[model samples]
Target: MESDKIIESILNDFNSFNIDDIPNIDLYMDQVTTYLNNKFEGSKRNDDDKLLTKTMINNYAKSRLLPPPEKKKYSKDHLILLMMIFYLKNIISINDIDTALSPLIKDYFNDGNNSLEEIFKLFIQYMKDTDDNQSIIDAYVKSNEYFSNLDNEDNKEYLQTLTLIATLTYECLSRKMIIEKLIDSLPKEENSKDKSDKNKSDKNKTDK
Candidate 1:
């Protein structure tokens, strides 16, 4: 019953925050950090933990995982990218993030057929559509059902917790593998060719 209540609470909070909530105005670095910290406060393990900091933002910029701010101010698009990067960094290495996001950044940063907001909105929708909340609840229920006949309550509880942890870990690992494969499947040379073509087009326009 406690687990059910906790799970329901988590599920209820899931969609409380959305990408549309990000501010449209360009923000200074301090403003960006404050906004992120406030927006992702629920993600923090403790009150003292900050979700984002100036130093982390600077490192991300230096790593080129984030596009440089215009006149030292970050746009809405920048915030979208940072939000993605924040979630991604927990699962994958920074280098992998750069590799995976290269195409997205090239096509949608600042200017593109689809705005970054639209793309991110679609992504969130897809996730929401695909996630099965019932499956999670079922897993928790099954964990409790297991080892029900065991005489030792302490051992039963420990095993049940371990079972739940293992289940979640396996699911995370499976998804991580899929992400790695998707990153590998991304076009490596096409990005360079596209850049070259754009450069040539600009040159021709300038000449004319």
Candidate 2:
């Protein structure tokens, strides 16, 4: 009665889902820390460095978003979501990041939500359609449930960064899903060999 099982069954029944859509989550997450370090390259953003400032952390919590590890700490599991955020910042409303992050945060990065995979699938579709659209700013802005608590102009940059970080959170989630689906698509040598041998033996038996 697992949720993915239910979804897989439905996809199989309707022929809308393919083996290509399944994901290998564990392998993808394992590489996140290293990938993040490369983004910083020579910069020293250690995992223990507490990349998120106190205000940033509070903003994420209030907006129900997540901040990634800075220098040393990083989570590959969250990489896809981070990438999506980066994509959004350039094309969509730079102010509504907290809204995009809500889905991942609420679903625990889509780890085990009953509808996690479906939501991820939806988000991917959304990205594909709107990732580069001009109305992206409006659509994204209207999508937010967060009414900012800020009244000071000095906090604009802080808010913008928070939004950017939230978008990153989303990128991590989406990228992770894509990676998992790609991994799941790989054929298993053992299973393929077993099936091939069985077919050969059955052919021999029929010939006899």
Candidate 3:
């Protein structure tokens, strides 16, 4: 399929979980897997694809990408963390995700004020309001226009594919560099505290 058409189809059928749609009660590992699978059903490439797995959740906790579940039950905070990781892992490193989200999680993971749930809801609303799909279409259109001078009609599709790949890679690299610079600008003490607390929390969970 043409890239633009595929992108349009995705935007038309984009499905994501709302804050109210997530369950209020804590869920066991299997339930968490089931919930994520259902929420991501529309985006899956195949019917047999698994959205989340027990092993992956365990790895996330072990890597400190997410907080440890209480009593083997995941809370809404955990769910929110997982959702953030799910989207980000495609384009960013796990270490970068840790650095980017550590402050938010440290301050708001379990707090009533400025909670992660609220933040997640805000993001959902922002996405709903944003013309991201149109922006993507415009970008693709502009890129094709810029490359329209290619006279070889037979290889136009191949060249267009290469151009798209190069453009997307450059875009990702630019954003990643900016994010890394911002992360480096954060106070060293704050980063240290976050790592220390994460280690302490992980150890306490293991010792229990």
Which number leads on lDDT?
Answer: 1
Q: Give the TM-score of candidate 1.
A: 0.82
Give each model's whole-structure lDDT.
Answer: 0.84, 0.46, 0.80
1-208 in candidate 2: lDDT tens per residue?
Answer: 2323433453343333222333344323235434433443323335555322345333433333454444433343344455455445444443344444544554566366454445556766764556343333433343332434557644644564456457656866786667556545654233333656889999999999
* Per-model TM-score versus the true fold: 0.82, 0.29, 0.76
Q: Residue 198 deviation, candidate 3, in Å?
A: 12
lDDT of 2 at 145: 24
Backbone clash numbers for all candidates listed: 0, 26, 0
lDDT (Cα, tens digit) per residue for candidate 3, span 6-115: 66667776634467888899999999999987877777888988777899999988876688899999999999888888877777777777778888888999788778
In model 3, residue pairs whose N, Cα or C atoms come closer than 3 Å (at least 3 residues apart or on different chains), thus clashing, are none
Rank the models by TM-score, top first. 1, 3, 2
lDDT against true structure, model 2: 0.46
lDDT of 1 by residue, 1-208 (tens): 2556667777766667588789989999999998998877767767898688999999888766788899999999999999999989989888778888888888999885769889999988987888777778888889999878889988887887778779978988998999989888877644443666889999999999
> Could you tell which candidate, 2 or 3, scores higher by lDDT?
3
